[model samples]
Target: MIRIAISAALLASAAPVLAETHSIEPGDGAQERLQEALILAEPGDEIVLAAGRYHITDGLSLDVDGVTVRGAGMDGTVLDFTGQQGAGEGLLVTSDNVTLRDFAVENPKGDGIKSKGADNIVYHRIRVTWTRGPHEENGAYAIYPVESTGVLVDGVKVTGASDAGIYVGQSSKITVRNSIAEANVAGIEIENSRDALVEHNIATRNTGGILIFDLPNLPVMGGGNVIVRNNLVVANDTPNFAPPGNIVAGVRRGTGIMVMANDNVLVEGNLLSGNPTAPIMVIAYVQPYDDERYNPLPREVVVGENTIEDGGYDPQLDGADMLKAAFGGELPPIMWDGLGSLYVSGDTPGWTLGLTEQGKGLGDAQPAPLAAPAPAADFDETGIGAPAELDERLG
Candidate 1:
């Protein structure tokens, strides 16, 4: 009997720990309390932030896998980093299978919430804002996820990011939907990522609404297989406010949707209006690149049928007056650099720079009306978007 009891006790001790909730409220020493809760959380545990504004001094980090960080609501629970003295971001997560939901981060000094190498992460109903709006000194990216796979960012709102409002880089199997990005340099950006679905997002009043780029010399290369559809990209006329040395600083204002150096990209079913530049732009990477693995030209890009209105009426390009006159008072809705293979699914009007090679100037451009073939067939959408299981967490 004694031996049996000892064995039963050992078995109970070896069982998995029951998940617990750590509740934190905003008040004096909230910074320490919040940090401690995050640090002490175990896998399959939750840290709940109560409804109030948490005045944080330094960045908060979470390295525990399978942890959920919940807050009252995006508007009810605020993490104000206005007085932040240190750290490169407001919150950093380096673990996998983590869920962050219903929180607001305001005035982060650098990037707002960055998840690096955190796979299977979900960011839901979160808001990040720069109160002053559209300044070069604002945070570089509001919601940033890099070097990870299986990312889902849904129902999030971001504003006034100097670089990008919602940025996913070096990741795969990503989905960004039901989000609003406004007053940012690049509203929504997918950089050096593969198999991404960007849909049902509102991108407005930014320098560039949606940018899909594949740049050289990154840890991940060959961004491709992206689907951008059902988005409202309008009036992206905010001046370029990115830091002078950033690549996005060169992005012309009023660009609705720009795809550069990516392969197998599909742009369709979007509502684009009031973008003074081309509503849809497909271009090659013009900068000189040393990476042999990088393909600087866009390939197999298909611009399907989309609702475009009042675009290219006040282009921000050089010799806009001449181009307008040449195109009968307004340029086409679509603009291409004419360096790679592009197909328009329908009869959407377009124009091209008609450059023979990358790194060519506009002076070398033989500007002409876009003459591209229709897509051979429907774009293959297999294996795109975030994993379906990420939505289960929201329930």
Candidate 2:
């Protein structure tokens, strides 16, 4: 019996493994080969692309859960979709526990890399770009993950997106760190997402550096508990070329960081400079809409311990005309729209906006004019207001 047990243990130890690896090289019919590999892939499989340019006309989709798609390196492996015939995104991921890393995706007709309804998804050391610079025809988002949970985007670089270079929308527990975004409408945007942490990022030469917005009419609403910290948000004066009807189209050029209609957001420990518009803007979503389901006011926002320099001059008049008229053509480092109703205690409830006094060019929020102009009847025509009123007291 002891001899039989020893032999059985040895046989089990020698059993073959189930993990498989597939590699695709650059050549004719590369897309077909990749598609075949994806179709054949199972859970716990790895697919690798060789270090060369794979010119693909159709978008790629991976629906296998727990699969890893890897490339030689972000600089060496390129997926060029300039001649894409697909009408949608470059890469679509719908599987849970998937990992995509170490590759570059360029010039897709739509979004660069998008993951929908995926959980525990990670995108690391990846680069996505539009080579033609910012244009309305460029893709909407570079790295977009919507309706995802436990999403992580780390050490990635994105550029030249018409809407947002790195956008995480309708997601939860997202972490975006050690990334760079440039020359996009809204460089890095967290829209309608909750429990997001955006840190250690450099956002420059975009229309708006980092945006936290909660707009009406989406799968998710009322984003909260976001933290934007330890980031360098600078310059960001690129012209806004987003196609009309997109929420980011309203982003003012030269703005560094904007928090609009979100709740419980913390902006801290960031270096903001060279943004001609307001370096930090906290505004309510005053768009006229009949949907009472959407909360248009930001609540319990705290802006603390940030370094501000050389901002709030030469505003983007197209979006900041009201700010120009109100502040004599010069904005402040920290601006808040005082547009909510006063509580019975003579102070706004959770609607109070807080900013620390440790930064330069920080100004107290001025009271809104009594009988201020009502927002445009069209929801899209309403502009985000300039500084109105803030407490300047940090809690």
Candidate 3:
């Protein structure tokens, strides 16, 4: 028999390829058995999403590259896209070392777990929610990663995202840690990313709390070697329900930790409280672009050492009560707009807007108070975050 059929084809090519799980369960067809186990997963498969509530009507995709779509614990595996009749994202990963753990995803009409160009991705403890909280047709982003490199968003817990409840665009080696962005408009956004690492994290009632934008014509413009440390930006006074020509509807409600137009950015040890529009904001990307390789300013920015409280009293600017009686009863937790290159180390108490140009707005005001100066050395923490083997897949 030809030597027993060549030893059964060399014992089936020397057997050693076991790597499957695929336990998907949850009533009825379960969206065709969870999109047929993410299209018959291969490369080290593991699509176990079994623990109830999966009424997803439409969106669900995965290109499969080292798959691992686990579940059964981001509040017990819910995935109920409130009868989604289409797609945009309710789970759309384009493959490459994927690992979206402990799922939840509710009401995902448009973005609630999107991972494009997904590379070394690892969004652990995922829980994108839009339980009708902050609406504008809620669902802009709830853990939406884009154009990846090696991103790791840990312990996720987004809520009501009208635009940004943990959104990382463009992307490079990124790492948005711990995580818990609430009432979103922009609660944790790092647009046009680069070597990023917004640490710890706990942005509250979001309108804008932790945003490091570098805009100008997209396909990824020069963002920065970013690193916003130890966060807990509080009381982000939500109200920017974004949905009108959205760009976070010009986030303002109670902005906190916003650094527009990046470069070697680094804001440190945070814990700002009751952020009433300015619990640390450095600007200059005042929009008016054509992207000649854009450079809207914010260079070498650094505002270290923080633990501020009762920020900017209640000033949603445009001369709010004469700047809160000229910074006596409020307004002062660092708010600069004087076009970039900022650095205010300790004794932090600021104010600026002395804009000279760049899409001039605030009525071209000259607010003044933030006398910056401090960090001159030791700021460069090379190659920022997200690439320590993506934290061993959040084991």
Please provide, for model 1 over 1-395, each residue's C-alpha lDDT reduced to its tens digit, 9 standing for 90 to 100.
25345436655788775687889999999999889878777678899999999999999999989999999999999999999999999999999999999999999999999999999999999999999999999999999999999999999999999999999999999999999999999999999999999999999999999999999999899999999999999999998999998889989999999999999999999999988988999999988879888899999999999999876998988899999999999999999999999999878999999999899878888899999999998999999999999999985
User: On TM-score, who's better, 1 or 3?
Assistant: 1
Best by TM-score: 1
Residue-wise C-alpha lDDT for candidate 3, range 1-395, written one tens digit per residue: 34245436655797654677878889988888889779766667788988889898899999978888898889998989899999888989998898989979998888998889988899998998988799989779988889999899998999988989988898899989988999998989998889998898899988888899888888878999999998899999988989878767987889888998899988999898998878888888876888699899898899999898877787677768888787787888898888868988889789897998888889878897988888889887887888898788787
Ranking by lDDT: 1, 3, 2
Alpha-carbon deviation at 236 in model 1, angstroms: 0.6
- 252, model 3: CA deviation in Å? 9.8
TM-score of 2: 0.81
lDDT of each: 0.95, 0.78, 0.87
Give all TM-scores, in the order shown: 0.96, 0.81, 0.40
- Pick the winner on TM-score between candidates 2 and 3: 2
Ranking by TM-score: 1, 2, 3
